[model samples]
Target: INKDTFHLSQRDTENHQTNLQKFCRICGGSFKSDPYKRSYPVHGPVDDDTQALLRKKEKRATSWPDLLAKVFKVDVRGDIDTIHPTNFCHNCWNMIQRKFSNSPSEVYFPREGTMEWHPHSSSCDVCGTSFRGIKRKKRSLNPQLSKKPRMVAGSARKARPVRNVKQVSNKAVMKRIANCNKIHLSTKILAVDYPVDFVKSVSCQVCEHILADPVETTCKHLFCRACVLKCIKAMGSYCPACRYPCFPTDLVSPVKSFLNILNNLILRCPVKDCQEEVVLGKYAHHFSSHKEAEEKEGYAYINKGGRPRQHLLSLTRRAQKHRLRELKLQVKAFAEKEEEGDVKSVCLTLFLLALRARNEHRQADELEAIMQGKGSGLHPAVCLAIRVNTFLSCSQY
Candidate 1:
């Protein structure tokens, strides 16, 4: 190899070797951030601290290296743990000792190869800790390997800042010493655009919304699966509507009667352009067709990063212009609609009040043009209509 290639290969090999040295032999986990990283050398004189610790627990061993070989199933014969860190970490050492010490073994693993004490104190090449004796510290996990606890079931409201623990909004964290036992974490049916139905048979009693993924309770009460699941998780196995035992085990199915009823019910498409009635059971299948059509025309896409996502956003100014055109087209369509019964009955006081309020001489040039004058080419009547509509629009809100 050339001189440059040789050096580069050497550097990569060194890095690979270093990474192997960081992992614990027992659990195959890192010790880079572990302060209590410890190991009982495969080649051992059996340190005094280690012997005493074992004796206190009424445990005896012929050889540490032999014990490790049997437990780990590795051919450990070296004085160094550079390639594979086949040395027990602090936590793993204590665990393995307690587990294996229950019943002492005599002839399981015959001590393999005689061991001799090094002249000087044998120290770890990784953390610079001595391998001669046990120097135990408060056991802690490597922060790099440690993970934050999973979020519990609830709206994750940001807690307001307070001076003391007493001033905190919720005492749930303070009261509990362990992780929450509630595993059924799902979104409430009330939060989503659920089916609208007046029939009580097809509705969830708990959420008061039309049933979504309906599940039956022991008390013959029906509810949204998410609603009951969350209720059982938070409030225990009693029915919310009635104090009947509603545990998951107590829940039973009434055949497919609920689904049969649901399949017969009609639902309107949520998409604004095509609000046609469809069978509730087939709504999702019908919606997928609209979705496919929209995708082909570049009208709908995944919001996440990709080519399809950027289709509308590629030319920002052009996208805005298209949006403006659509809005204007909608307004034109609304104007063409026949104004029959109750057309004048709708609220217009907000419009009149806003129009009069903006008709002052001190208004900006843009506002002046909107009202009337030579700046705008619109008729007086048209200007009044425009002013009324603009002021009454939700943009003001």
Candidate 2:
């Protein structure tokens, strides 16, 4: 029994020595023992380069496990807890120290029921100036400085009492009278829920008369239809009010509601002795009737005249006929001149004569038809004259 126990003890000792020989003491790496090699102690203070190499190896070994764990989305703390406690490698420790070298080492943790300490600066950070108390100056004790002077109730200067004396001018009085007359005249017509001077306000800006068939331009200016057309013909394509570019085609008809309102307005007859107040829509008819009545009265007056008056009337008619014949002859001459290629002078002459005899619609119609038949050969001036004549005839109607 003693021999067998000794053999078992030797076997146990050899196994322990072999296991110890397989591992390095410094880096904890495994190695095989070789008969040709000599072994030395590796755990000791190394040279700077050797120490750096070991630190780098340790860092790489430690960091890879952490990085791999993070990449695989594994809980680092749980993994470490399952294996071993977390300890910084040499390089990591040095790196952390370098990163936070300027940071405070100790952080304050207030105890329960204890007030936290706060730090404050004694000087201004910007100018580095320390604060100091300043002494204020004392006021004088003289009576003038201490008390305000008082004046007697009656001694204060009184403001001059202003009296506005208005002087009445004769012209102003006359204007007021004219306004009153206009109001009186307007009152005779339909009663409108507008100011007494509203008629004047709604009058055409171009003609300074009550608007007839009012049209509004794109520029927002309002004008009578005929008045605006006349202006467009005279002036170029532009607004009269602000000179904004606007063409005749740009003039829009007033809204139907607006036209209805205007048509409802009552106006007095324009005839000298006629006192008829007619709605604007029927004014044309009323005026035509008045003209017909005036012509009949004129004819009756001539028929009721004595022999001498009849003779005088006959002579006047004969002279008017002679004048008409002369105008016809002049027109024919101008037309001949135009056909002979004297366009400018002939066109001017024709336009002037047509304008002078614009009231003769029959003659105007004949002239317009003749010029239009000439087509492209007609002078522009002559065409303008025909257009003006047409406008005048339409206006008369």
Candidate 3:
């Protein structure tokens, strides 16, 4: 094969050496950068041990092209045309592809070089300390391993590995803590006194198992990532410790954090009838299955000339007199839920009342433009049109 195959070029070797040196410089000697640059793909006579050693060394090497080959399959140093720039390398790529195989490109790689983390800590929650436990990557990849085929549902599946917590040097961690010393810890809950007595140790409040990893809200309230997400799911973005309003995006790298927490917590599906306890990382898929099943059951609450979810219509009527004042209050309460987008359904109730109150609001054209921008596709526009048509029909009813 060596006689027929192209040998490693001088330039390729030089670039490989340079990348190795760069890695050595960045990681010090704690890791070997270019452990096997000389071990080219053999055509002839290397011993099995030597070949195995070479492969192992190649795995540890971090050169972009080399790592690219190991991670993905095509040699990045070779014909770049053979692989797209977006090809996955093996490290975590298989899991990523299987999990998020259906996600929109926008969600997967929003921008180049953009990565985020969720913590898996071992120390004081508020202080965000990493006391002694080893930081291990907990991935969410089981759904990929299943051989059974499943139908796709609303939106593409956005399965991703849970976020990893940032591993700053102990010095950097202390520095960050010091920078926020002036930010007072809430006196409302003493360190010794916790909301749940069993939670006295640094365990997550949600499952009440697994040592908790600290996550912060914009309000600086500290809770286990899992517990806080559950609180957010149930209670919205207000700080549980204090009533301070916080945004979902401000929930300490939320998507990554939630994914990490979910990945780590493999739980049985809570829906009645199906009791599969998928790992948290696979929850997106489980929920997708749940959602598809729910859709097959058809719209539950449709009335004459009215869409399903008519109880929401009553809420809309109530919101009209008070301008959805009740929902405004309750909205904050349910703000953290995955169903919050459905809360937009609540807008139907409010809009209906508004239609009764005045004609001075958005004309159809203005509303269409707004919907187009937010919807991102023909389906959204069609949906908005259907909802508008429904409300107009309801007025007659």
Candidate 4:
């Protein structure tokens, strides 16, 4: 055969071979096909049996439709009363068969036992402090291999092997610790007392407020979960502190040690007049009372300040009332001016005010209908008049 014909035949053979390679119909993992090995067809009946067993053992009715949808990545058309035949790899077939055939072995105690000395030291390697109970074993680094040069294909010079640096320098370690000081600082637990500088580093850089439910980015910079989420939503996926590219998914839960510290920290009441020092765990409950008190005081203050600057208040009220009246007149005149094609200013201002009100109340449906010129149960003229009246009344002291 000619070279071109032989190459074409070889390409076709590869394509055929790839097409013949079967995937595990159950798990969806690629099955390794061997010429010498015999393939077995493990149908979905075994899967149903295993699932039944699992449900029985767990004593809970588990829905497989959601899981099947994710696995198949298709909208299932009908109810799955029965599963179709599937081709399973040898290992998967064996595993399913063994699971069905065998029962789990129970734990049993030995009649005699012997004890040996633990290989771990009684003190921490880094801090050189004695451990309370059983000390944790120190992790030993692998022995460094000698670098050897290797000859590369089509290259005259030999390529030198890259030396892997495993040992961290003391300065680099200290710098990393300093960078993570924010997490340690916020921790109130005395179990691991950090430096004063570390303790003071718990505040968010954006709001300069004590971090709550802190999430750390890939760059090691920490921020409050809400603050960071808001920043990311408003801006783009980038760390506010270091400007390092970070996604919401990259924000990880703080370590258990940090969580313990955060929960135990003493926080002051956020209200201006309240001087209550609250535990971090109890802050949520305490803050609610503080907020209610502040709101009550605010209403009381508004009522008490009625006659303090009566003249100035009266002037401001009169100005607001005049503006409201002018707006109302303009809206009224729009019906006639609309026919003359001069309704943009009056209509737009009224629409904008309605939109502002809708946004403030988060009534998206009402806003959409209003924007479409569909009155929300009330006549547009009546709504505008009511809004203007409310605005004028609110402006009055």
- Using all chains and alpha carbons, the TM-scores for the candidates as numbered come to 0.27, 0.28, 0.18, 0.26
Highest TM-score among the candidates is held by which one? 2
Please give the RMSD of candidate 3 to the true structure: 27.3
Candidate 3 stretches with Cα past 4 Å from truth are 1-251, 254-262, 299-397
Per residue, candidate 4 scores C-alpha lDDT tens digits across 282-318 of: 7778867867886898777354454563443457766
- Residue-level lDDT tens digits of model 1 in 71-119: 4444466545435553445544553453344322211111222222221
For each candidate in the order shown, give its overall lDDT on alpha carbons: 0.52, 0.48, 0.41, 0.50
| Residue lDDT tens for model 2, 1-397 | 8899889766544443433344332222233333433233222233354345547546432333343232222233432211222222232222233322323232221112111211222232211211121234564566756575556656554322222111134224323322333222233354445675666556665554566667877556677677667656665555554444456776777778777777778776756887677877887788789779988987774444555543434567767666468666776687676566555457654664675476654444455556556534456566567668667876632
For candidate 2, the TM-score is 0.28
lDDT of 3: 0.41
Model 1 residue 30 distance off true place after TM-score fit, in angstroms:
62
lDDT of 3 at 73: 35
- What is the model-wide C-alpha lDDT for candidate 4? 0.50
- By lDDT rank, best first, the candidates go 1, 4, 2, 3
Between prediction 1 and prediction 2, the one with superior TM-score is 2
In model 4, the clashing pairs are: 185-198, 185-199
